[model samples]
Target: MAGLITCLSVPFLSYLGLRSLPAQETAPRTIVNLEVIVVDTESKALEALERLKKGEKFSTVAAQMSIDPNAGNGGYVGEAEVASLRPELRAAVESLQP
Candidate 1:
Protein backbone atom coordinates (compact mmCIF):
# COMPACT_ATOMS: atom_id res chain seq x y z
CA MET A 1 0.00 0.00 0.00
CA ALA A 2 1.03 3.64 -0.53
CA GLY A 3 0.92 4.32 3.22
CA LEU A 4 3.24 1.40 3.98
CA ILE A 5 5.73 2.49 1.27
CA THR A 6 5.69 6.08 2.55
CA CYS A 7 6.39 5.01 6.14
CA LEU A 8 9.20 2.71 5.07
CA SER A 9 10.70 5.32 2.73
CA VAL A 10 10.66 7.95 5.49
CA PRO A 11 12.76 5.81 7.74
CA PHE A 12 15.08 4.81 4.94
CA LEU A 13 15.59 8.44 3.90
CA SER A 14 16.14 9.43 7.51
CA TYR A 15 18.72 6.70 7.93
CA LEU A 16 20.55 7.80 4.79
CA GLY A 17 20.52 11.41 5.89
CA LEU A 18 21.86 10.56 9.33
CA ARG A 19 24.49 8.27 7.86
CA SER A 20 25.70 11.03 5.51
CA LEU A 21 26.57 13.34 8.40
CA PRO A 22 30.27 13.79 9.08
CA ALA A 23 31.72 11.82 11.94
CA GLN A 24 32.80 13.84 14.97
CA GLU A 25 36.44 13.71 15.99
CA THR A 26 37.11 11.95 19.25
CA ALA A 27 39.75 13.34 21.60
CA PRO A 28 42.99 11.41 21.91
CA ARG A 29 43.28 9.19 24.96
CA THR A 30 45.93 7.11 26.66
CA ILE A 31 46.66 5.41 29.94
CA VAL A 32 49.10 7.33 32.11
CA ASN A 33 51.14 6.14 35.08
CA LEU A 34 53.31 8.94 36.35
CA GLU A 35 54.21 11.01 39.36
CA VAL A 36 53.74 14.76 39.62
CA ILE A 37 55.04 17.31 42.06
CA VAL A 38 52.50 20.05 42.38
CA VAL A 39 53.76 23.37 43.56
CA ASP A 40 51.72 26.44 44.48
CA THR A 41 53.44 28.93 42.18
CA GLU A 42 54.53 28.90 38.56
CA SER A 43 58.06 29.74 39.63
CA LYS A 44 58.12 26.79 41.97
CA ALA A 45 56.65 24.50 39.35
CA LEU A 46 59.35 25.60 36.89
CA GLU A 47 61.95 24.90 39.54
CA ALA A 48 60.57 21.44 40.05
CA LEU A 49 60.66 20.82 36.28
CA GLU A 50 64.28 21.90 36.21
CA ARG A 51 65.11 19.55 39.00
CA LEU A 52 63.47 16.73 37.09
CA LYS A 53 65.46 17.61 33.97
CA LYS A 54 68.62 17.33 36.05
CA GLY A 55 67.54 13.84 37.19
CA GLU A 56 66.63 14.67 40.78
CA LYS A 57 64.56 11.87 42.29
CA PHE A 58 60.89 12.58 41.70
CA SER A 59 59.74 11.27 45.08
CA THR A 60 62.26 13.36 46.96
CA VAL A 61 61.31 16.59 45.20
CA ALA A 62 57.63 15.79 45.53
CA ALA A 63 57.91 15.15 49.24
CA GLN A 64 59.78 18.42 49.75
CA MET A 65 57.79 20.74 47.44
CA SER A 66 54.38 19.38 46.48
CA ILE A 67 51.29 20.90 48.03
CA ASP A 68 49.08 18.05 46.87
CA PRO A 69 47.71 15.58 49.41
CA ASN A 70 49.36 12.76 47.48
CA ALA A 71 52.78 14.27 48.20
CA GLY A 72 53.18 11.97 51.16
CA ASN A 73 52.43 9.08 48.85
CA GLY A 74 55.36 10.18 46.67
CA GLY A 75 53.04 12.01 44.28
CA TYR A 76 51.66 8.81 42.87
CA VAL A 77 48.28 9.48 41.27
CA GLY A 78 48.13 6.00 39.71
CA GLU A 79 46.82 5.06 36.29
CA ALA A 80 44.13 7.02 34.46
CA GLU A 81 42.70 7.20 30.97
CA VAL A 82 43.49 10.65 29.59
CA ALA A 83 40.09 10.91 27.91
CA SER A 84 38.35 10.58 31.27
CA LEU A 85 40.07 13.73 32.45
CA ARG A 86 38.74 17.29 32.00
CA PRO A 87 39.21 18.77 28.52
CA GLU A 88 42.23 20.96 29.27
CA LEU A 89 43.92 18.29 31.31
CA ARG A 90 43.18 15.64 28.71
CA ALA A 91 44.74 17.76 25.99
CA ALA A 92 47.84 18.40 28.06
CA VAL A 93 48.29 14.75 28.93
CA GLU A 94 47.80 13.67 25.34
CA SER A 95 50.65 15.93 24.20
CA LEU A 96 53.17 14.14 26.36
CA GLN A 97 55.16 11.02 25.44
CA PRO A 98 55.53 8.04 27.77
Candidate 2:
Protein backbone atom coordinates (compact mmCIF):
# COMPACT_ATOMS: atom_id res chain seq x y z
CA MET A 1 0.00 0.00 0.00
CA ALA A 2 2.80 2.49 0.86
CA GLY A 3 4.62 1.71 -2.41
CA LEU A 4 1.48 2.40 -4.46
CA ILE A 5 0.87 5.63 -2.55
CA THR A 6 4.48 6.82 -3.18
CA CYS A 7 4.12 6.12 -6.90
CA LEU A 8 0.89 8.08 -7.13
CA SER A 9 2.27 10.99 -5.11
CA VAL A 10 5.44 11.26 -7.24
CA PRO A 11 3.44 11.72 -10.47
CA PHE A 12 1.06 14.17 -8.77
CA LEU A 13 3.94 16.28 -7.48
CA SER A 14 5.60 16.28 -10.90
CA TYR A 15 2.35 17.40 -12.49
CA LEU A 16 2.05 20.25 -10.02
CA GLY A 17 5.65 21.33 -10.71
CA LEU A 18 5.01 21.44 -14.45
CA ARG A 19 1.85 23.49 -13.96
CA SER A 20 3.70 26.05 -11.83
CA LEU A 21 6.35 26.73 -14.51
CA PRO A 22 6.13 30.00 -16.47
CA ALA A 23 4.61 30.02 -19.91
CA GLN A 24 6.71 30.27 -23.08
CA GLU A 25 7.89 33.66 -24.33
CA THR A 26 5.73 35.56 -26.80
CA ALA A 27 6.60 38.33 -29.28
CA PRO A 28 6.16 41.90 -28.08
CA ARG A 29 3.11 43.84 -29.25
CA THR A 30 3.51 46.45 -31.97
CA ILE A 31 2.12 49.99 -31.66
CA VAL A 32 1.82 52.40 -34.57
CA ASN A 33 0.90 56.03 -35.26
CA LEU A 34 -1.09 56.40 -38.46
CA GLU A 35 -2.48 58.91 -40.91
CA VAL A 36 -4.78 58.25 -43.82
CA ILE A 37 -6.44 60.02 -46.72
CA VAL A 38 -9.81 58.53 -47.57
CA VAL A 39 -11.30 59.20 -50.97
CA ASP A 40 -14.48 58.37 -52.88
CA THR A 41 -12.89 56.48 -55.75
CA GLU A 42 -9.86 54.47 -56.78
CA SER A 43 -8.78 57.21 -59.16
CA LYS A 44 -8.88 59.80 -56.39
CA ALA A 45 -6.86 57.57 -54.08
CA LEU A 46 -4.27 57.00 -56.75
CA GLU A 47 -4.05 60.73 -57.35
CA ALA A 48 -3.49 61.40 -53.69
CA LEU A 49 -0.70 58.83 -53.61
CA GLU A 50 0.91 60.47 -56.60
CA ARG A 51 0.76 63.88 -54.98
CA LEU A 52 2.37 62.59 -51.80
CA LYS A 53 5.17 60.94 -53.77
CA LYS A 54 5.75 64.17 -55.69
CA GLY A 55 6.28 66.29 -52.54
CA GLU A 56 2.85 67.69 -51.78
CA LYS A 57 2.49 68.25 -48.04
CA PHE A 58 0.39 65.56 -46.33
CA SER A 59 -1.59 68.01 -44.18
CA THR A 60 -2.37 70.23 -47.18
CA VAL A 61 -3.56 67.37 -49.37
CA ALA A 62 -5.54 65.66 -46.60
CA ALA A 63 -7.37 68.84 -45.63
CA GLN A 64 -8.20 69.63 -49.25
CA MET A 65 -9.13 66.18 -50.58
CA SER A 66 -9.90 63.55 -47.94
CA ILE A 67 -13.55 62.74 -47.26
CA ASP A 68 -12.96 61.40 -43.74
CA PRO A 69 -14.00 63.55 -40.78
CA ASN A 70 -10.43 63.51 -39.50
CA ALA A 71 -9.34 65.30 -42.66
CA GLY A 72 -9.26 68.47 -40.65
CA ASN A 73 -6.52 66.95 -38.51
CA GLY A 74 -4.45 65.89 -41.55
CA GLY A 75 -6.03 62.43 -41.51
CA TYR A 76 -4.30 61.58 -38.27
CA VAL A 77 -5.78 58.33 -36.94
CA GLY A 78 -3.96 58.36 -33.58
CA GLU A 79 -1.77 55.64 -32.06
CA ALA A 80 -3.06 52.08 -31.99
CA GLU A 81 -2.00 48.50 -31.42
CA VAL A 82 -1.09 46.93 -34.76
CA ALA A 83 -2.89 43.70 -33.84
CA SER A 84 -6.12 45.66 -33.36
CA LEU A 85 -6.05 47.06 -36.88
CA ARG A 86 -7.94 45.46 -39.78
CA PRO A 87 -6.04 42.67 -41.56
CA GLU A 88 -5.24 44.68 -44.68
CA LEU A 89 -4.06 47.68 -42.68
CA ARG A 90 -2.09 45.45 -40.32
CA ALA A 91 -0.14 43.86 -43.17
CA ALA A 92 0.68 47.28 -44.65
CA VAL A 93 1.76 48.79 -41.34
CA GLU A 94 3.87 45.74 -40.42
CA SER A 95 5.79 46.06 -43.68
CA LEU A 96 7.00 49.51 -42.71
CA GLN A 97 10.23 49.98 -40.68
CA PRO A 98 10.40 52.18 -37.58
Candidate 3:
Protein backbone atom coordinates (compact mmCIF):
# COMPACT_ATOMS: atom_id res chain seq x y z
CA MET A 1 0.00 0.00 0.00
CA ALA A 2 2.89 2.47 0.83
CA GLY A 3 4.65 1.71 -2.47
CA LEU A 4 1.42 2.29 -4.42
CA ILE A 5 0.80 5.64 -2.72
CA THR A 6 4.39 6.78 -3.28
CA CYS A 7 4.18 6.12 -7.05
CA LEU A 8 0.92 8.08 -7.36
CA SER A 9 2.34 11.08 -5.45
CA VAL A 10 5.48 11.42 -7.55
CA PRO A 11 3.73 12.40 -10.79
CA PHE A 12 1.40 14.83 -8.98
CA LEU A 13 4.37 16.54 -7.31
CA SER A 14 6.16 16.86 -10.63
CA TYR A 15 3.13 18.47 -12.23
CA LEU A 16 2.83 21.00 -9.42
CA GLY A 17 6.46 22.00 -9.70
CA LEU A 18 6.16 22.50 -13.44
CA ARG A 19 3.09 24.72 -13.03
CA SER A 20 4.96 27.09 -10.69
CA LEU A 21 7.63 27.91 -13.26
CA PRO A 22 7.51 30.94 -15.56
CA ALA A 23 5.27 30.62 -18.59
CA GLN A 24 7.97 31.76 -20.94
CA GLU A 25 9.37 28.39 -21.79
CA THR A 26 12.40 29.57 -23.78
CA ALA A 27 14.15 32.77 -22.76
CA PRO A 28 16.48 34.49 -25.18
CA ARG A 29 19.94 32.97 -24.91
CA THR A 30 22.05 35.12 -27.20
CA ILE A 31 24.36 37.59 -25.51
CA VAL A 32 24.26 41.23 -26.45
CA ASN A 33 26.02 44.39 -25.34
CA LEU A 34 23.75 46.67 -23.34
CA GLU A 35 24.29 50.33 -22.51
CA VAL A 36 22.62 51.55 -19.36
CA ILE A 37 22.01 54.92 -17.79
CA VAL A 38 20.49 54.89 -14.35
CA VAL A 39 19.37 58.18 -12.91
CA ASP A 40 17.79 59.41 -9.68
CA THR A 41 14.68 61.04 -11.15
CA GLU A 42 12.33 61.02 -14.12
CA SER A 43 13.82 64.24 -15.46
CA LYS A 44 17.27 62.73 -15.43
CA ALA A 45 15.99 59.64 -17.22
CA LEU A 46 14.49 61.88 -19.92
CA GLU A 47 17.75 63.74 -20.30
CA ALA A 48 19.68 60.52 -20.78
CA LEU A 49 17.17 59.37 -23.37
CA GLU A 50 17.62 62.59 -25.27
CA ARG A 51 21.37 62.12 -25.30
CA LEU A 52 20.94 58.68 -26.77
CA LYS A 53 18.62 60.03 -29.46
CA LYS A 54 21.27 62.59 -30.42
CA GLY A 55 23.75 59.79 -31.14
CA GLU A 56 25.99 60.72 -28.24
CA LYS A 57 28.46 58.06 -27.22
CA PHE A 58 26.60 55.78 -24.84
CA SER A 59 29.53 55.26 -22.52
CA THR A 60 30.18 58.98 -22.31
CA VAL A 61 26.55 59.70 -21.58
CA ALA A 62 26.42 56.96 -19.00
CA ALA A 63 29.52 58.25 -17.27
CA GLN A 64 28.09 61.75 -17.12
CA MET A 65 24.52 61.10 -16.04
CA SER A 66 24.35 57.74 -14.32
CA ILE A 67 24.57 57.60 -10.52
CA ASP A 68 25.35 53.91 -10.51
CA PRO A 69 28.64 52.81 -8.96
CA ASN A 70 29.85 51.27 -12.26
CA ALA A 71 29.24 54.46 -14.24
CA GLY A 72 32.95 54.87 -14.89
CA ASN A 73 33.23 51.54 -16.65
CA GLY A 74 31.19 52.93 -19.58
CA GLY A 75 27.98 51.37 -18.25
CA TYR A 76 28.83 48.18 -20.09
CA VAL A 77 26.53 45.62 -18.56
CA GLY A 78 28.10 42.85 -20.65
CA GLU A 79 26.14 39.78 -21.73
CA ALA A 80 22.81 39.21 -20.05
CA GLU A 81 19.93 36.75 -20.04
CA VAL A 82 16.51 38.02 -20.99
CA ALA A 83 14.86 36.08 -18.19
CA SER A 84 17.03 37.82 -15.62
CA LEU A 85 16.31 41.35 -16.82
CA ARG A 86 13.53 43.61 -15.62
CA PRO A 87 10.43 43.78 -17.80
CA GLU A 88 11.30 47.14 -19.35
CA LEU A 89 14.86 46.16 -20.16
CA ARG A 90 13.77 42.81 -21.49
CA ALA A 91 11.44 44.55 -23.88
CA ALA A 92 14.23 46.76 -25.11
CA VAL A 93 16.49 43.80 -25.75
CA GLU A 94 13.70 41.93 -27.52
CA SER A 95 13.32 44.84 -29.92
CA LEU A 96 16.91 44.55 -31.10
CA GLN A 97 17.62 42.77 -34.38
CA PRO A 98 19.39 39.47 -34.12
Candidate 4:
Protein backbone atom coordinates (compact mmCIF):
# COMPACT_ATOMS: atom_id res chain seq x y z
CA MET A 1 0.00 0.00 0.00
CA ALA A 2 2.87 2.38 0.86
CA GLY A 3 4.57 1.55 -2.46
CA LEU A 4 1.31 2.16 -4.32
CA ILE A 5 0.93 5.58 -2.71
CA THR A 6 4.58 6.40 -3.51
CA CYS A 7 4.04 5.51 -7.21
CA LEU A 8 0.81 7.51 -7.35
CA SER A 9 2.43 10.44 -5.56
CA VAL A 10 5.35 10.44 -8.03
CA PRO A 11 2.94 10.87 -10.97
CA PHE A 12 1.07 13.62 -9.09
CA LEU A 13 4.33 15.42 -8.30
CA SER A 14 5.50 15.00 -11.90
CA TYR A 15 2.24 16.45 -13.11
CA LEU A 16 2.71 19.44 -10.83
CA GLY A 17 6.15 20.02 -12.33
CA LEU A 18 5.07 19.42 -15.92
CA ARG A 19 1.83 21.35 -15.90
CA SER A 20 2.16 24.94 -17.16
CA LEU A 21 0.09 27.86 -18.41
CA PRO A 22 0.63 28.98 -21.97
CA ALA A 23 2.90 31.94 -22.51
CA GLN A 24 1.13 34.74 -24.40
CA GLU A 25 2.84 37.34 -26.56
CA THR A 26 1.09 40.65 -26.43
CA ALA A 27 1.75 42.82 -29.50
CA PRO A 28 0.50 46.29 -30.33
CA ARG A 29 -2.19 46.20 -33.00
CA THR A 30 -4.06 49.19 -34.39
CA ILE A 31 -7.09 48.25 -36.46
CA VAL A 32 -7.96 50.39 -39.49
CA ASN A 33 -10.32 50.01 -42.42
CA LEU A 34 -8.50 49.55 -45.75
CA GLU A 35 -10.43 51.97 -47.96
CA VAL A 36 -8.27 54.74 -49.45
CA ILE A 37 -8.20 57.10 -52.50
CA VAL A 38 -5.27 58.44 -54.49
CA VAL A 39 -4.75 62.14 -55.14
CA ASP A 40 -4.56 63.30 -58.80
CA THR A 41 -0.87 64.05 -59.43
CA GLU A 42 2.63 64.65 -58.11
CA SER A 43 2.19 68.44 -58.38
CA LYS A 44 -0.83 68.28 -56.10
CA ALA A 45 1.09 66.23 -53.55
CA LEU A 46 3.98 68.68 -53.67
CA GLU A 47 1.69 71.64 -53.10
CA ALA A 48 0.30 70.06 -49.96
CA LEU A 49 3.82 69.43 -48.69
CA GLU A 50 4.53 73.08 -49.21
CA ARG A 51 1.49 73.94 -47.19
CA LEU A 52 2.64 71.65 -44.38
CA LYS A 53 6.06 73.39 -44.43
CA LYS A 54 4.17 76.67 -44.08
CA GLY A 55 2.77 75.44 -40.72
CA GLU A 56 -0.57 74.13 -41.91
CA LYS A 57 -2.24 71.06 -40.41
CA PHE A 58 -2.81 68.28 -42.96
CA SER A 59 -6.03 67.16 -41.25
CA THR A 60 -7.66 70.50 -41.94
CA VAL A 61 -7.13 70.12 -45.68
CA ALA A 62 -7.96 66.44 -45.60
CA ALA A 63 -11.33 67.36 -44.16
CA GLN A 64 -12.25 69.05 -47.41
CA MET A 65 -11.29 66.31 -49.89
CA SER A 66 -10.67 63.01 -48.15
CA ILE A 67 -13.29 61.19 -50.30
CA ASP A 68 -14.46 59.54 -47.11
CA PRO A 69 -18.01 60.64 -46.35
CA ASN A 70 -16.71 62.52 -43.32
CA ALA A 71 -14.21 64.54 -45.34
CA GLY A 72 -16.50 67.52 -45.80
CA ASN A 73 -17.40 67.58 -42.11
CA GLY A 74 -13.89 66.74 -40.91
CA GLY A 75 -11.21 64.35 -42.11
CA TYR A 76 -11.57 62.87 -38.62
CA VAL A 77 -8.94 60.23 -39.21
CA GLY A 78 -9.26 59.19 -35.60
CA GLU A 79 -5.92 58.25 -33.98
CA ALA A 80 -3.68 57.72 -37.04
CA GLU A 81 -0.52 59.72 -37.68
CA VAL A 82 0.85 60.49 -41.18
CA ALA A 83 3.33 57.64 -41.04
CA SER A 84 0.67 55.20 -39.85
CA LEU A 85 -2.18 56.57 -41.93
CA ARG A 86 -3.78 54.82 -44.89
CA PRO A 87 -1.42 55.44 -47.81
CA GLU A 88 -3.92 57.13 -50.09
CA LEU A 89 -5.47 59.12 -47.26
CA ARG A 90 -2.05 60.44 -46.32
CA ALA A 91 -1.33 61.31 -49.94
CA ALA A 92 -4.68 63.01 -50.41
CA VAL A 93 -4.23 64.98 -47.18
CA GLU A 94 -0.77 66.09 -48.15
CA SER A 95 -1.64 66.85 -51.76
CA LEU A 96 -4.89 68.63 -50.93
CA GLN A 97 -6.00 67.74 -54.43
CA PRO A 98 -9.40 68.71 -55.75
lDDT of 3 by residue, 1-98 (tens): 35542211112237447333334344447666776788999999999999889999989999999988769988876777676788988898888887
Residue-pair clashes per candidate, as listed? 0, 0, 0, 0
Model 2 pairs in collision: none
Per-residue error for 3 in candidate 4, Å, reads: 34
lDDT for each candidate structure: 0.78, 0.83, 0.76, 0.53
Give me the overall lDDT of model 4: 0.53
Taking every candidate in turn, the Cα RMSD to the unseen true structure, in Å, is 11.8, 11.8, 10.7, 15.0
What does candidate 2's lDDT look like per residue over 1-98, in tens digits?
35542211212247447433333444578888888899999999999999999999998889989999989999897999999999999999988877
lDDT of 2 at 55: 100
Q: Worst lDDT window (10 residues) for model 3?
A: 4-13
Candidate 4 per-residue C-alpha lDDT over 25-90 given as tens digits, one digit per residue, 9 for 90 to 100: 434554443332225677766665676689877666555435566565445535554557668766
Alpha-carbon TM-score of each model against the true structure? 0.61, 0.67, 0.60, 0.37
Report the C-alpha lDDT of model 1 over 1-65, residue by residue, as the tens digit. 35542211112247447433333443456688767788889999999999889999899889889
User: Which portions of model 1 miss their true places by more than 4 Å?
Assistant: 1-29
Stretches of candidate 2 exceeding 4 Å from the true structure: 1-27
- lDDT accuracy of residue 47 in candidate 3: 90
Model 4 Cα shift for residue 8 (angstroms): 32
The number of the candidate with the highest lDDT is: 2
